[model samples]
Target chain A: MKQDSCQVTVIDRKRIELARKQMPGAEVLENVSEVLKLLGDTTRLRILLALATTELCVCDLAALLEMTSSAISHQLRLLRARGIVKYRKEGKIVYYSLDDPQVQSLIKVSMDQIG
Target chain B: MKQDSCQVTVIDRKRIELARKQMPGAEVLENVSEVLKLLGDTTRLRILLALATTELCVCDLAALLEMTSSAISHQLRLLRARGIVKYRKEGKIVYYSLDDPQVQSLIKVSMDQIG
Candidate 1:
């Protein structure tokens, strides 16, 4: 028999069972993975990090990043759809901000990890 | 003239300038995005989550996930390369665990956001 990298000489049944039970269901894992994928983009991550500090209008984000307003809007639309960001209209100018504490926490924790 | 979705009727130069200053450099942003991308995968994320709770050898993880040892080892190699996970050899068995507190924080915040 070919030696497998994961050779099971001593199986810790107790630990394995505990980890299996702790694992989230498939649906939740899929949902969380999708959110992480959305955030995996540099443009979107920058947008969220910028928004975490302060709210800005679409054009403001474009200006801040030196990117086109249209480009910024496209990413913002995706972020909004996922509830990672929220926007409100103030007399025709729409201001976008982090949707909730959860979004802020995500940004903070991820940044801490990379920094 | 076509109106852009991010039409700038009133420019907030101060906020825009502040946000620009606050934005991380390209290298840092790239690094963070890469980390997020790695965790974005369901298998890798699950593996990390499991290791977060208890240390497990490669075969242990394979059994817990009901996946082949080769698949689990593949993901572990990637995670190990990124410093997201660490492993130690005990005789012929290698045990894997989370590398740092940063990884734990990343998992917790992300789960909180999704939950």
Candidate 2:
């Protein structure tokens, strides 16, 4: 029996050429990374998770995370800027929630994959 | 009618206090990030997608992507390190495939979310 070890690595020129033409470009990857990186953190992930399950005001998130409302506000600011979450102002009381359905789906999938 | 802007923001001490006890910690978020980051890249995501559909050797991937086998190997190395993908040997020919079902699920969710 002969193993491929001694043989030269095979090059599927046609396939490789076709893929180079078909694969996505830098812009798409960069965009995807931005979204994932936002979800990559402990605080943000928790914030997003909490929001996904239910809309909450800053005080609510602060209470849940045991963090300062100031701290929670800072993270929420980032999430809002990226369009990952959205807020509705009802007077001084602003409630936040996941802005995109994809965000919720992505998080659910993330949980399933890790589990 | 007075908007809450001029008023002191209300803090739901009871709700906030309760939530702090329920949320997750740093460890879980960090672990989830690891998986998401691997899929964050364009090339790696592409590789994972290819493998998810069909197992292929390095050369097959290289051919399909129109990349040098060396470039493909480098990406595969990163994916393997993260446990995102795996490979088997047939002589010198090593074939690769995704190691977990979660990877596929995550990608699908990502696509749906982004789409």
Candidate 3:
């Protein structure tokens, strides 16, 4: 396949170096990648969007999205593990919400653009 | 495997109804998922971060990320198709940058939260 690159090989070392310096470190990038990957799924994204309005337990999410509670909870576990979502206990019931405001804004910004 | 859901089966119909009404449409959620999935890759995310500073050609992205121009171009094509990134022609050289301000903010928000 023909590579999608510039025919000329002029390397702007200074600009590239500046961007590299400004970029977050490897560990941070990895964490961000993991977060985005989790959010990429339709089910998970829907769950986050629903949770954005208010916290919901697995049953609530499943009912809202029309999926099984097992599937919703499975995704919630992954979200919690990644720190994208947090759970609180009220008696025997558990509610899950977005852990980071930044993530909430990420969804909001994305929705505004496409919606 | 055991499910990770609340044992209780009390569905808050009112809350779920409210959340469902407040959520974005299915099309928007799918679009957001596609965008997040694209950003989920480290190389693609790094390319976006670099472009966030300024536009660059595939060769420039390759040099910055230590990847081949072909690989960079491939990801760039995918990003362009999804409207996440845009490219312009300067003589014989082509430069790519984030296509939407919303996408730019998404990256910024993600960076601020995790960085």
Q: Every prediction's TM-score for the first chain?
A: 0.79, 0.79, 0.76
* DockQ for every prediction shown: 0.46, 0.30, 0.44
- Compute each candidate's TM-score over C-alphas: 0.81, 0.70, 0.83
Which of 1 and 2 is the better model by DockQ?
A: 1
> How much TM-score does chain B earn in each model?
0.80, 0.76, 0.79
Better of 2 and 3 by DockQ: 3
RMSD of 3: 5.1
Q: What interface RMSD, in Å and to 1 decimal, does model 3 have?
A: 4.7
Q: Tens digits of per-residue lDDT for model 3 on B1-115?
A: 1332434354587778789889888887888888889889999999999999888887778878878888889999898898889999988778888887878888887788766
Q: Could you give the DockQ of candidate 3?
A: 0.44
Residue-level lDDT tens digits of model 1 in A47-93: 98888778999877887776787899999989899888999999978
lDDT of 2 by residue, A1-115 (tens): 2122333244544544454564456666567767877777778888888876677898777666667778889999999998989999999889998888777778887876773
Q: What TM-score is obtained by chain A of candidate 2?
A: 0.79
Model 1 regions lying over 4 Å from their true place: A1-10, A90-92, B1-10
Which ranges in model 2 have alpha carbons more than 4 Å from their true place? Answer: A1-10, A17-30, A59-63, A66-71, A90-93, B1-10, B17-27, B57-75, B90-93
